[model samples]
Target chain A: MKESLVIQANNLSKKYRLGTIGMTSLREDLSRWWTRSKNGIPKHGFDQAGIDPTRMINDHEFWALHDLNFEITRGEVVGLIGANGSGKSTLLKILSRITEPSEGKVKVKGKVASLLEVGTGFHPELTGRENVFVNGAILGMTRREVDKKFDEIVDFAGVADFIDTPIKRYSSGMTVRLGFAVAAHLEPDILIVDEVLAVGDLRFQNRCINQMKSIAESGKTVLFVSHQMATVENLCKSAFLLNMGQIIYSGKTSDVIKKYREDMEESANLPISQRMIREGSGKCKLSGIEFRNDQNKVVDSLISGKSATIKLFFDIYEEITAPMSLSLGISNSTHVRIAHLCMKTFGKWILPTSQKSFQVNLSLSKLELNQGKYYVTSFLDDESGQIIDWVTDAFVINVLQSDFYGTGMVPPTSQSIFLMDHSFSF
Target chain B: MQKQSITVLKPSAGWTGFDFAGIWQYRDLLYLLVRRDFLAQYKQTILGPAWFVLQPLFLTVVFTLIFGKFAQIPTEGLPPLLFYNSGLIIWSYFSHCFTGNASVFTANAGIYQKVYYPRLINPLANCVSGLLGFSVQALFFVGYFCVYKIFIPTASHFEMTSAMLTIPLLIPLVASLGLGMGLWMSVLTAKYRDFNQITGFLAQALMYATPIIYPLSEVPEQYRFWASLNPMASVVESFRFALLGKGSFSFHLLCYSTIVAVLLLLSGIYFFKRTERRVVDYL
Candidate 1:
């Protein structure tokens, strides 16, 4: 016998207007009421009428999730993977009934418990013991159920010693741990986790993941959202890859990962200016930034320990040749800077010409950056120590894993970066 | 784990009604929240629950001195202390409930954003907790009445009737009115936020508009129609009549206030439910 699916979302979409004032006043109320009334009954399978032409020009309306369709069978652990702003959180919010969709409909069975953020149900003034029952209730567990699971939750959170202490006094990690324990023990039919495990220490993170795994194994459908691809691969058999508010790929975890990697590579090929860069303080003026491989074709791909150059074209608006220096730093997707290179100690090259546009290329025999998303930042400084220009995030690049480096190390070195040589004779 | 005992199932589509059953299921959570509010409010305070009694006692003395002794406002033949204290007790309960419910969304926006709960529970729990505070204050009124009856018996006349039993019924009515207005204002404040600043002023204006400091009969007869139109005016008068058995309690006014309370409460819940899911988007 085939098991029935727990959730079925058909052509679901959500649209939000940008930078508009929210509901207020009797005038806006009457207008909104009229609009909602004239649009006909908002129900599943009905097409939403177009926005009123009489209204002022809206800056823009973007679909957070667009034309998505999927089904999840009971007890399936489905991982939702996407880059930032890819609508993973939006989808989860809709599933958890925290918000309604702009279009389409979703059908869910049984009670749903969503841990969109750890410690969401906790009140700062309430004690740890009080929060357990309160949060458990917020997640749909009955009082007797909380009582039955109270001890188990306290033990799981390791907060029995401070159970009577107010949550306001608890550290953030402790709060998150206790919050997760309450949600985990509630035993809902469907569990929604959205990057909450990233809050605590490694041990707590491991415990949360294991709890989720056990939850899925206990015949409950689980929808897990995370940027941690390895964790997704290890836990979820099925995966959905979201890109630009659309489902780009949905299938077995391996296939989705492959498609996601390919899509990342395609995005990497785009010019740094055309690619999305988070709004940054443009203190330092950057004229030109390019990534080029050995053939000098401005290719996106780079081989570990192979020759590559970051050609930085700059213009010095204010003339100061006082040991002016250039520095470049690379950062991962989480914006953690992994490596840095500076021209201060290397000595600055004199401008061949006083023209506004000039080029400086940094050559590397081997790229020691790991295989993942990387962004580069360049800074301009005076040798006299008075910094002239500083650009925090200038360009982004993707460093793909190559056969030479293997999965763990860069530059294919026999000895690690620590340069340790060990012979175990136990 | 046990062999997949329950088969996979999907949630039903379409507009769903308020889940009363779900709210009932979370009753324990509601109690926990109520308990937390009760304990936490007086936790660090020096006087603790004594503050509850002192507030009304002090306010009653002040009101008696100003309205009774100075202005010589008529109290419909009740002792000045008994008259003023009755008004203060009822008004305090109403004001506390209104303020508490009105700040529900703004105060709890952090938790509202993170988890999904029946948003109704926030206001409901607040009303329940406010009732507890009101009860503590009501005990003070009883203490003062006992002293008045014993020490100053000839200063006032007192009587008890079955109409006094109707006092308990007014609890739900007063709660619903406060909750209704509170939720409506709470949702609006979430969007405009200016309402938060203005609410204190509005509540003060409402207090003066109601017969909290003076008797309903003290208002000019021409303005009595307008004063009685205020829903809370009838509520405060009814509460006074129930406790002191002196103020006016028109059955027609009671019916009208009850109707208004019901309408406000329902509309408040409707607007609150509509805004609950989307409030987080703005917050």
Candidate 2:
């Protein structure tokens, strides 16, 4: 324990049984209890170590978080960056007391408020004014505290005229704004947020960022988790990168984000067939994917306003006369989808022959995507709307900048992910 | 310098980790939850809050027809309406408290998974909110009893007895038994979902097991011991004797039910506190 440190974790770990967590039947519990009583109960869990992977696969037990140790000092705004299932959420759950850790401990000084979600306990039947008090109390604020900040919250949400109406009638955007407003007014010693900024419009997002900045400036601690690296870069000074239930890097936010990018690139380098992260039935599968320039030479990156072609190689196991549709989406580093190309929208479908394998080429005369790192997600669906194959973050395509308007200038990628083809008449 | 409080969270709180103070700190939330339950139930309906009184009133009349008039069940010489209303009044409180809290973990898993608060607050709120309906029905019962004794003819055997002094004491007895059993059932129902389907059936069977529609004197002496083990049996009978002054009452039976209530309350708190810490993981 240190004088300035507000939160500390020592060897914290959480083990989750993959399926059928506990006894589902009294007969099973009874038999197990009888055996344990006769053979003497075995001491297991928590302190148990050296679990083999094969045994874990068989027994359906795995540690979601393993021996995580970190500390946050007062007034520090830290970002936790990790891919899906990298244990960021488990750590947050343990910190928020929503779920207990399997081993070790986490200590915090002063009161802590965790907003794992906005409108955590809102009732649709309750009015906006009533829901505000309920949501505030669920976030650990007292009745008098909510009363003191009621006017400010309503003003911030900008729903003064409809405060007495049931939130069920409010638009989804209005509900989100009011929910975020109540959460933002909580004055706890420490605040933990998880992807709540992914909601609301751009204007409200900016308001939320400003409110977070003011909270940090007031010497309160914040531990934020998000998939959006741009927001992390803007809000956090230091960050931690987690991979496979362990902290791989911890340093300046910029350096950590670079490490995250490198991690994504490394995963993208693997051959498509060998990647473990995929979904849908295996009737048809993506065998390979490649990007090529206008000259038909294979390239890893495409330049804006230049002709390029994307080739998708599929392997079909059982063929029929059913028509199938193909879709490819490109998303920026912030995980926001920027471009989508679907065959069904154009009223065109593919009828695969008896061939076990085939290649489909999508040629673009001029790339409209802005200059940035983008990830590709591919989906294949049949006539019945059943997904044949779906892969996310299947590959990465780097888009380079070009002057579409021949002005030798371009807008920042942050302004928009698409560069429109236009000319100045004035 | 401002004084700071440090909290250290561990894997488990062990057997002795009863958090009475934690529940006390979240008392405001408990009150708000109770208010929400009371206000939110009858919304968007024509008869708002009137259903509170009408529900028990309708049940009492139905029971008076089937069990009193048709089946010829004895009410220990009291009017059938007064007898049935007396039983339904206390029975509904216990049943509401029990069944309302029985599925607490499964019903509120959404909130419990994302927030941190005393899990006991949910069931405790249900108990308190059950009182709102109980008081309304109790008032109706008192008015009906007055109508029978003073207004209705051929009903002159009713007299308020000294046992009526213990009427206020019956509230906690019923509340604790219901909450205790409900807490235990919450854990069981969360563990085995099929158990949830039978809770309503069990509550109905339990009502018949106790002397709700009939007097305790009707049960044979051989089965009275097993009947007294129900915990609610003595409470319901004592409520009848206290209010209408014409039902069975025994000191030993009352003492026995009191002990069961105390034990159930203590053990229910212990088991609920232990289960709630990690209930969300499995749920």
> Model 2 scores what on Cα lDDT?
0.85
Tell me how far the alpha carbon of residue B73 in candidate 1 is from the true structure, in angstroms, after superposition: 2.9
What would the per-residue lDDT of candidate 2 be over residues B1-283, giving only the tens digit for each residue? 5978899987876675557888888888888888888777976879999999999889989999999999999899898888889899899999988899889999999999899998988999999999999999999888887787787767868877899888888999999999988988888887877678878998999999999899999999999889888989999999999988877788888888889988988888888878887788888
Could you give candidate 2's per-residue lDDT for residues A1-426 as a string of tens digits? Answer: 899999999998888875454426666667667888888964232311223253242345777788888889999999999876678998888899999988999999988999898888889998999899888888888899999999999999999999999899999999999999999999989999999998999999999999988888888999999888888888999999987677889999999999988887787778887654455555777889789998999998898888999999988866646888989988887677778989999998988678888888999998888888889888888889877777767888899887766777766767777887776796
Model 1 misplaced stretches (Cα beyond 4 Å): A1-3, A23-59, A276-426, B1-18
Instruction: Identify the leading candidate in terms of lDDT.
Output: 2
Q: Which ten residues in a row have the lowest lDDT in candidate 1 chain B?
A: B3-12
Model 1, A75-183: lDDT tens digits are 8999998765578998998888777787888777777888887666677777898888777777778888989999999999999999999889998888989988888
| DockQ of all predictions against the true structure, Cα-based | 0.36, 0.66
TM-score of each: 0.79, 0.86
Candidate 2 Cα errors over 4 Å, as ranges: A20-58, A276-329, A333-337, A340-367, A370-373, A377-392, A398-426
Evaluated on CA atoms against the true complex, candidate 2 attains a DockQ of 0.66
Clashing residue pairs found in predicted model 1: A6-B9, A107-B11, A108-B10, A108-B11, A109-B10, A109-B11, A305-A366
Best prediction by DockQ: 2
